[model samples]
Target: METEPLLLSTSDGVATVVINRPARKNAVTQAMWVDLAARANILSADPDVRVIVLRGMGDDFSAGADIGEFDTLRGDATSARAYEATNSAAFAALRNCTVPVIAAIRGICFGGGFGLAAACDLRIATADAQFAVPAARLGLAYPQDAMGDIVWAAGPQMARYLTYTAGRIDARAALSAGFLLEIVEAERFDARIGEIARTIAENAPLSVRASRAAIRAALSHDAEEAALAQAAGDATFLSDDYAEGRAAFAARRTPMFKGR
Candidate 1:
């Protein structure tokens, strides 16, 4: 089915979510934010989906939040709060998803766009991709969650540079800053992205999910406790996928994971 702001399709255990407002460089609207949150919720619950790939419909990933919405937000505290909540919810959906999310970035990834990319577990960008957070230019402050996401992906120093100057960085610089997993030339971007997605899909689903959960837990402050670490390790040991993996190794054949 088609939606106004987002287009979603699922096949071969992968869900593809495309931002559809290419005429405006896919600048996100309030409605679009709601749709994104909904889509994330749906994808997260789909047993058939092992991975999610987020991308823009046309040349650019997104220009940022639609400026036209600002007028409605100005001096309206309730409206502003609601908008922020919607955006935050959308980002949270991506972060909390059981399935891994990948950002396949192309042209511009700015402001909200950058935040979205940072929320994904992996990012594959074209050589021509450009990244920025232009809150400085707009005389606005980013929310703590957004700031934390940026810091997590690119480190404090890089996050500071991007937010302070509101300058654009090329794909290579983004990779160096740890904002992207890899950068491929535009001509080869699609093939490379597909290969990565297929590789992930071919893996045992339960193992992948457990790894994602463990990584997220380890990144959180609670992970500093020895008890939590031990608990997580024990859980992994008890998982059926772990048993299947060991058995497959002994059998000298590929293992099939049923996500048990």
Candidate 2:
């Protein structure tokens, strides 16, 4: 079956976002980025989806933005800004989702692809996965807001290293550089991702949401960050799922969570 540039599918509380332009290594066009933002909005509003996963349709995750359209779409400052806005919005959407976002990477993930993966809450890669940031070579500037994802994922030093060198790094280097959470063999990658998605899907949504907030708080530097984090954690304690969790533990059975 031929896949669209991007595809969103939800099943059993898990939503998958697929970048499907494998003919060009999943190179995303401006339209695809807009669609990604729209899909992120849809996934966030969907209560049935407790988690979101991003992946590629074929071997390579993505080669980043489709440069073939650059002559027209990014030829001028106005068009360039507008074009980049779609990318920024897509990344922001992924970051803003309260539900955890996981990036399942298999092959080439560079430039914009690397940025998106860095924006995800978690990244799982296959042994063949490779990453790079080619802005330096192309004489382009990486925007400050978008830079946060790379900075947060790999630290300011590594971010600078990757950008300055513009060198491609394999899964082992990416993981060693703290860009990926786990790396599985290519043969077992799909199964491992499925297992992880199922485990997250089976958990209490309330707890998951609360935990996401708490983890995000670690990234905040605002004066009230502590208060906000505490409030979020406190709210979960009063949730119906919390009661169900206690009861289920007492009864020695699985608890059903409704995301309330």
Best by lDDT: 2
How well does candidate 1 score on lDDT at residue 250?
100
Candidate 1 residue-wise lDDT, 210-239, digit = tens: 677778777775644445446555676777
Q: Give the per-residue lDDT of model 2 (tens digit) for 1-260.
A: 14578888889999999998888999889889999989998898889999999999889988998889889998888998898899899889998887899999989999999988988998999998989999898777776677998999988888998999998888998888888999998889989888898899899887887787777777866557667667878888888998999999999999988877
- Regions of model 2 farther than 4 Å from truth: 1-3, 224-227
Between which residue pairs do clashes occur in model 1? Answer: none
Model 2: ten consecutive residues of lowest lDDT: 220-229
RMSD of 1: 2.4
Q: Which regions of candidate 1 deviate over 4 angstroms?
A: 1-3, 223-236
Judged by whole-model lDDT over C-alpha atoms, candidate 2 comes out at: 0.88
Candidate 2, pairs of clashing residues? none
